[model samples]
Target: MSEKQQRLVLSIIEFLNQSIADGTVKQDDREGLEVAVQCIGEAFGVDPNDESQVGRLSIKPASLSSLFDLFMKTRERMSGSTPSTSTPSPAASSSKVDKEAAEKEKEKGNKFVSAKKYNEAIEAYGRAIALNPSNAVYYSNRAAAHSFNNDHPSAIIDAQKALEVDSKFVKAYNRLGCVFDRIQVESLSNLSWRI
Candidate 1:
């Protein structure tokens, strides 16, 4: 990594360390944050404990929070200077294309479901969901694929994600209910077998 990037990583490590010490991070997550600091330090080939590494950022941004705030302000300034236009910005155009692509991927997933290829269906729906995470139907479709694959845990998670995306989506609620029913039935079946 470049020195600039390393400096930034060092600043992030410093921030994480400070959070751990200041009790901003939960006690349970402190160890994981420490591990993350170690990994970031190793990845950047910089030692967080070494004062010099942490001091480099002091020239401009004393900490990661300040650096981020500076970045956001700069972004706001840049955005304000852009002229209003009828044509869409590149990012907005890209989002439109992504929505179309997500729909296509969802169609592919539906075809896979009809063919009883649960894994392929799951992968297709995953791509769709990744592209357009706001779409509850993609998540619900993935949940169905997971259910067909007998992956109850994944089905439950996807259903929950679907609900998160659109709370009023009845399909997600049904999918969640169905997964719970299936789990109950499986538990009963296993108990009966044991008996």
Candidate 2:
């Protein structure tokens, strides 16, 4: 690994240590270190051009243990399998292609959001939502972009829609709470200053 890659790994390791200190990572997980590593690989976006940084962007375990267990088990299962080893049928190939295209559209949306191009981001996310309507993340992401543009009403509507689709989405809940908090604080300040 390059020096940059080494530094990234060290930074993530430090984060892991802090999480452990804060009781984010349980002691039992230490026994399944390999599974954890694989889980990291499955979640992280490995660069196509730089496979060495496969687990560069590490994610943490959610509050739910069962879901984390499931993710780790799935990653373990996939670790033994090679991408080129599978002989996917024609229907499977077509389905995979469709999924990839949808993911590509989502990437474009994310790029626009990162660029602070809120309106264009919303449009890109809209296209992604059309391609994968069932995905709650698409709606939630667009809602965030809408919020960034100061379209709080539209953001609230989209966030509500996302929550309707996936009630378990904590991100949607957090965003909604933040929006409500902003409104509440503004109204409270106005009322207090009016007197």
Candidate 3:
């Protein structure tokens, strides 16, 4: 592609990244994002159908999801309402305040996790859970800490609690599946040794 065309494609990619970061588009709108990228590629005389080029055009998952995504996803996991990609609700200001506090605690917990302070991370997550008992993420995060500490039974318990609060929570399902698999593997290993 010519220099001008390359610049245009880059510009379009940047715009899309910004939209994704701002949570203006839903995480599930990957197809629409791909179409938009394809259109931009075509406008710049590039082969939009090229798989490598398409892959390069796509947003990074970590970059695509912002803190807002976490908040919305956690809320969705608990409540059945689909969070609109718009301004915060005035009617739920008080609840939002509570959520914000919980999120702050979660951030601290995340930091502790990154530092490998498993026990402290668990405590922070516990605080978040206490503040926002309805948030599935709080339970899920605490379960992760438990798993890291090799406490599979506690992890399973917390994962179950998370799913109990939010049956549609995908992360909880994945965690539960992982814990179950681990338990099965342990049981089989013990049986083989015994035999």
Clash pairs detected, candidate 1: none
The 10-residue segment of model 2 with minimum total lDDT is: 54-63
**Model 3 misplaced regions, further than 4 Å:** 1-94, 184-195
Once fitted onto the true fold, the runs of candidate 1 whose alpha carbons sit more than 4 angstroms away are 1-94
Q: Model 1: which ten-residue window has the lowest total lDDT?
A: 83-92
* Per-residue lDDT over 1-195 for candidate 3, one digit per residue giving the tens place of the 0 to 100 score: 665455346546656756777888898996689678778767776553454543443322212233234445556646766445433322323377788998999999989989999899999999888777888898899888877776776786687667656667789867756764665455445446444
Q: Mind giving the per-residue lDDT tens digits that candidate 2 earns over 1-195? A: 454454344345445545666777778875465355445534543332342332332221111242343345334433643234222212222355566676787899899999999999999888877766666788889888988886776777677556555556778767766665554455445445445
The TM-score of predicted model 1 comes to 0.51
Angstrom error at residue 129, model 2: 0.3
Better of 2 and 3 by TM-score: 3
Candidate 3 colliding pairs, count: 0
Task: Judge candidate 3 at residue 8 and give its lDDT.
Answer: 44
Model 3 RMSD in Å is 16.1
Candidate 3 whole-model C-alpha lDDT, 0 to 1:
0.67
The TM-score of predicted model 3 comes to 0.46
**C-alpha RMSD between model 2 and the true structure:** 17.1
